[model samples]
Target: MKKTSILNKLRSSGLRPTKQRVEIAKLLFNRDKTFHFTVESLGKHLAKKTTTKFALATIYNTVHAFKKAGHLSEVHLRGKNNTTYFDTNISNHHHFYDSETSELIDINDNEIKFDKIPKAPNGKTIKNLEVIINLKN
Candidate 1:
């Protein structure tokens, strides 16, 4: 993505387009397709790209900001470890998780069918539907 475009995105999201945010946005949004990453892994990936490196806390802060701006969503797996995955694809979709390899594959919304959906609580509405199908070798 171009610098101007990224800057515009940041501004539209009410975020100041700082040097660090721009670089982080490049890593997060310049790709052709959506993928998932944790702050730790993202920091490692960014460290390999350039001589300048961001602190681990910076990565977490940037990711959280992006998530708040609706550019990313969290994927919570069922486990005691409670590792978090960020998804770049904000559109409605499901995921197939390969637990052994720690891989996540996108599942098109139309591919899955739900027979019925239960009612939400008195004042709440169903915001989203997420399905994480675990896989094994």
Candidate 2:
């Protein structure tokens, strides 16, 4: 993504376009498709790809901020160890989680069918329903 576009995104999200943030956005949004990732992995990725080193905390902060601003979506891996994953594609979709490979593949919304949805507790409504299908192979 161009600098101007990235800057505009940041501004629209109520975030200041700092040098570090711009670089991060460039790496993230410039890609053809947005993939799922964690802050730890993203930190490691930046370490290898860019000369500008960002603190691990900074990456975590920025990622959370982006998610809050609707630039990303968060998926929780359910298993022995639950890990939080972020997806750049914010559109409604499901995911196929390969536990062995630790890879997340996108599944279109219509692919999954729900026979029934339970009612939410009183005074509250289910905001969003997402499914993370775990795969062995």
Candidate 3:
């Protein structure tokens, strides 16, 4: 999407069109699929850029705001510090995490289906179900 279009999207989503937010959104939504990123990695990536320089705190704030506005989702990976990854797909699906490379791969929804949901002992309904199939080299 063009910068103007992205800015319009942010505004339509009730987010203030800050330069940092727009830059981050462009990165997150530029690709055809979702991606996993760490704050440190993102900072380092942004640091090398001249046009878009975002502070670590600003990245966190923008990410949180986008998440709150339903523009992104946070993935919780085991043995990792609450690493926040954005999902532009915004559809129900699973993920395949390559442990060695720490890559997040999307599994198509049609490729898998559950005939029946397993019962939860505590009478808790499943709000969302995600399968993170860990792969080893």
In candidate 2, what are the lDDT values of residues 66-134, reduced to their tens digit? 888888888866534566788998998989888887889999899988999999999999988888888
Clashes of 1: 0
TM-score of every candidate: 0.88, 0.87, 0.82
- Residue-level lDDT of model 1, residues 1-137, one tens digit each, is 78787886677667787777788888888888887887777888788875666877778888888888888888866533457888898889999998777778889899999999999989999988789898888
Q: Is candidate 1 or candidate 2 better by lDDT?
A: 2
Best by lDDT: 2
- lDDT per residue for candidate 3 within 1-137, as digits (tens), equals 67787786687667788777777888777676566676676677666663776877898887777677777777666634446565565678788888677677888878788898888669677787888888888
lDDT values for all models: 0.81, 0.82, 0.73
Q: Which has the higher lDDT value, candidate number 1 or candidate number 3? A: 1
Q: Model 1 segments beyond 4 Å from truth?
A: 78-81, 121-123
| lDDT winner between candidates 2 and 3 | 2
Model 3: pairs clashing at backbone N, Cα or C within 3 Å: none
